[model samples]
Structure formats: structure tokens, C-alpha cells
Target: MLEEDLLYILALQRVKGIGDINAKKLISHCGSAKNVLKEKRHVLQKINGIGAFTLQHLFDKGNLKEAEIELTYIQKNDIETFYFEDKNYPDKLKHCIDAPILIFKEGNFNLAKQPIISIVGTRKITSYGRDFCEKLISELKPYNPIIVSGFAYGVDICAHKAALKNELQTIAVLAHGFEEMYPKSHKKYVAEINKNGGFITDFWHNDALQRENFLKRNRIVAGISEATIIIESAEKGGSLVTADIANSYSRDVFAVPGRSTDNFSKGCNDLIKRNKAAILTSAKDLVEMLNWDLETKKERAIQKQLFVDLDETEQQVYDFLLKDGKELLDIISLSCKLPVYKTITILFNLEMKGVVKPLPGKMFEAI
Candidate 1:
């Protein structure tokens, strides 16, 4: 984004009572963040949900000064900024209504065309949880997914280390700003993580760490990926909160099942019981559910029928799957530029014609 727009966006972000949803509303109505600041108070007040309180600090001159300072810091540190509308913004996150308008990134990784999943659990992890977390990442190595976590203790750090060991990109979503690192002992892993994947946060460089920040950061962990995996958790913990957020965003959630008597397993079992998450027994379950194993499936030697018929839309969807192998329904919809409902209907039609077959996890493969 241009510096001018970024300056105004930072100022808007600093305003009190104006969260992402409202900021986006204001920006949409005014056509730009800069325009929103310059818009007449009466004009803004007329917009739905734009009350007097949200606008109280909207016009604060100090907001601009703070934004300038933060922008300078960002530039000095070589931090990258992704506006919500930017093409480079995380694709899944962009669809989330509550996603941050802008995210600051410091990493060597690129998210383009890669599958991403967040693995989160209790800070007090058990031996079983540790083993499961490590094994899951190692097993997923062939798919080369981008692993995401909060960069906290236990499962978070374990996931990061596993991804690094497997030579895969792993993103650490921070609850604090780039200026501070929590659990100071984990600072030792920072250099390696930076070299491999890197850190992401919506917080400013100098923002102080706060208890609530962890919960707030969970949304990013949940929203930025295709799915979330909880290796272990107590009946109540931040990882469960992340699961809830993932569900709210309509993302897939999986929980590693454990002995019912185990304290940490209670959360996973409860989630499975409540139908909030699917049972994750091993890497194979996740691989099938996400269609990540499709690439490894041997090609079927089926001869094409000379008389098989298909419409333009159906042909488009079929052609994509033929080239890409089995793919998620949403991916097909996106690639075909068709609505999901339309894609499903077309896929069904293709199925009827014996040209496609449905698979687990809402995926379809051309026959």
C-alpha cells in the first residue's frame, strides 16, 4: 500500500472504540482510511453503527502522530505490512469479518498456494501431547504445509521446532509486539524461526505485552489457516478458545483423542462429543480429511469416452480437477470462479455422468 494510506490506516487503528469491523465500515463508506478521517462528523454519524463514541477519538490529532512514529519504526526494522485488501494478504484470513485490517510480518516465508494449519494446545503439555505434535508435523512433511502457532510454551514451540526440523515453513503468531518476546527463554529459537518461517502480529512494535493479548491473538491463529489441530488441552484453555474461534470462522477443527481419564484429553474428548471438532487419531486422518494425500494417489488408467457430454461450467470444473488431481470443493469453486453451491451442483452433475467421484472431506476427483 501507499505510505499515505498506511499512515491513515495506522491512525484509524489507534482510535479507541473503533474495532476492525467498524474501521472497515468507515473505510468502505468514505472510500479510504484517509477519506474517513477527513469525512464530516455528521456524514460519518449518519452511517449505520457509526455512533458518536467511535468517532470521539477518530479525529484525534495525536493518532496521526502515533501512527507516524509506528510507521517509522516499521520502516526502520524492515517489517512488511499487509493491508486486508492487498492481494498478498492471507487468502483465508481476508474472508474473516473480524480479521485485522493490517498485519505486520517479519518472515522469509510465502503463503501462496500452500496449505496451512494451526496446531495449538495447553502450555503444560504431557509426553503424549509432545509426541503427537512432533509426529503430526513430521508426517505432514511430504505435503509441506505451513504450520502456524502462537509461539507460546509447550505445543506452540513444539510445532515450530518440528516444522523447522522437517524443513517446512512455520509461522509464529505473537501475542505481544515485535519489541517483546514472552517466555524469555524461548528467545533462543527466534533466530532459527526467522530464518525458516518468521513472526506475524497485528500489534505495534512498542506495544506492551498483556494477558488478554494471548486470547486476542488466537483469532489470527485460527483465521489464517484452512484448519486447526489441538494436540492436547485441559477442559478449559486458550487452545479451546482457538478452536471456538476456528469454528466461528467456519474452518475445520480437529482434536487429537486421548485416554478419557487423562486430564488434558478431557478437552479433546469434549470437543468430539459436542461435535465441535473431528477426531484426529493420526496424520493419516488429517491427510485424508484435507485431501493432502491426493497428490500421492496413483493415477487411474481410465480411457476417456468419446461421447461423454458436459456443459461449459461443468467442463471447466472437470478440466481443473483433471489437471490438479483431487481438490477441495472450495478450491474448485475458487479456481472455476463459481459459487460453492454452483460448484457442488456441477460436481454432482459430473458424478452422474461418471466423470468424477466424491471423496472424504468434500473433495472431488475427475475420473
Candidate 2:
């Protein structure tokens, strides 16, 4: 976006009572943020949802003044900004109705066409949760997914570190602005994270860290990814809020089941019981649900092998596909007398072995 346009957007953000949704409405009604600010008060009020209170502060001169200062900070620090309507904005997040109209970023990673999943849980992570989180990322390394987290203690930090260890890009979504690091201790990871991926926030450069900001930022964590995983959470925690947001956005959510007696597992178990999330036991569960192993037609030639070996279950799935030519995933599972999850896992294995290939609409065929 042009600097002039960014200036108006930032100024619009400074206006009180006009949140993301209302701001978006105003921006859409008018041609741009510049026009919205310059538009007459009566004419603006004529648009739906634009009331006296919202437009009361829309013409504040200080809004532009503060925006100019922040714009200079952005230019000087080389901060990247993503406008909601811009093609470069995160594709998944753009679909969300409550998504930020503008988000500030400072990162070295590219989100284009990459598999992104947010891993969020309690700050008081247990040994069990830590192991599952690390192993999950390690197993998913082959798929080259972008790991996203809040950059706090426990599971969030663990996910970021695991991604870094596996040489994968990791994004840290902050609850504060670029100038403020909430946990001063996390400063050590900033340089490394910026090198591997980077930090993103909707807060301004000078905004102070606040408790409510954590909940507010959860939307971005949920919206930016194709899925959100909860490794561990107490009966109540921020991770649960993220799960709710993900569900609201209609994105896939997975929770690692844990012992009923464990405090940290209660939230995840409840999510599963409430039908808000799928049971996530291992990396295969996620890969199968997300169809990450499905190779496109162009890539099928290279993926197929002249000779390959398959286990009994894999062979059954492959043979069925061969005989049927094409079949729905559920039909194959019913014919093989296996559960849907197990059927998906077996089919993925066959795909990897170059014997079976996935087609559109959950259909599969033999090579």
C-alpha cells in the first residue's frame, strides 16, 4: 500500500469506538480510508452502523499526528504492514469477519501457500504436554509447515523452539506492540525467531502490554492458520479461547487427548467431548485430516515409484482402489472394515508408497 494510504489507515485506527468490523464497513462504503476520514460527518452517518459516537472522533487532528509518528517509526525500522484487502495478507485470515483491518509485522518468513498451524496451550505446561508438542512438530517436519504461537512460556515457546530446531519457519504473535516484549525473558529468542520466521502484531509500536491484549490477539493466532492444536490446557485458559475462535472461523481444531486425572488435560478432553475439536493422538491424525500428504496431479509422476512395499492395511487399501478404479474414502473404509481415521492413515501410507492417489471430493484411485 502507498504510504499515504497507510497513513490514513493508521489514523483511522486511532479513532475510538470504531473497531475492526466497523472500520471495515466504513472503508468499504467509502473508497478508501483516506476518503472515510475526509468524508463529511452527516454523509458518513448516513451509512449503516456509522453513528454519532463513532464519527465523533473520526476527525481528530491528533489521530493524523500520531499516525505520522508511527508511520515514521515503521519506515525507520523497516516494519512490514499488511492491509486486509491486500493480496499479500494471509489468505485464511482475510476470510474472517472480525480480522484486523491492518496488521503490523516484522519477519523474514513468507506465508504464501504454506501450511500454517497455531499451537497454543497453557503457560504451565507439563512434561507430557512438552513431549507431545515437540514430537508432533518433529514428525511434521517433512511437510514443511509454518509454526505459529503466542511466544509466551510453556507450550507456545516450546512450539516455536521445536519449529526452529526442525529448521522450519515459526511466527511469534505478540500481545503487545513491536517496542514492548511482554516477557522480558523471551527477548533472547527474538533474534533467532526473526531469522527463522518473525513476529507479528496488530498493536502499535508504542502500545503497552496489557492482560486483555492476550485474548484479543488470540483471534489472529486462530485465524491465520489452517488449523489450531491444543496440546494442554487447564479447565480454563487462553488456549480454549483460541479453540473457540478457531471453531467460530470454521477452521480445523485438534486437541491431544490426555489422562482424565491430569489438570492440564481437562480443557482438551472437554473440547473433544463438546465436539469442538478432533482427537489428536499423533502427527498422522493432523496430516490425514488436513490432507497434507495428498499429491497433486503434476507431482504424482515424481511421487510414484516403480517398486514399493506396503503393509497389510496399506495393500488392502491400494488393492481396493485398483479394483474399483475410484471410490469415496468412506466406502473404501467400510469395504476394508476399518475405521475412517485408520482408513485415512492407510490411504496416506499407500499414497506415500506410490500405489494409491487421492482425487477430488474425498475420492481415491490406484496408480
Q: Name model 2 segments beyond 4 Å from true.
A: 296-367
Candidate RMSDs in Å, in order, are: 4.9, 10.9
Candidate 1 lDDT tens digits, 186-302: 999999999989999999998889989887799999999989999999999999999999887767899999999999999999999999999999899998977665544333322
Tell me the tens digit of each residue's lDDT in model 2 across 175-275: 99999987899999999999989999999999999989988799999999989999999999999999999887667899999999999999999999999
In candidate 1, which residue pairs get closer than 3 Å at backbone N, Cα or C atoms, i.e. clash? none
Residue 287's C-alpha lDDT in candidate 2? 92
- Candidate 2 global TM-score: 0.81
Residue 208 C-alpha lDDT in model 1? 85
For this target, which candidate reaches the highest TM-score against the unseen true structure? 1
Pairs of residues at least 3 apart in sequence or in different chains that clash in candidate 2: none
TM-score of each: 0.83, 0.81
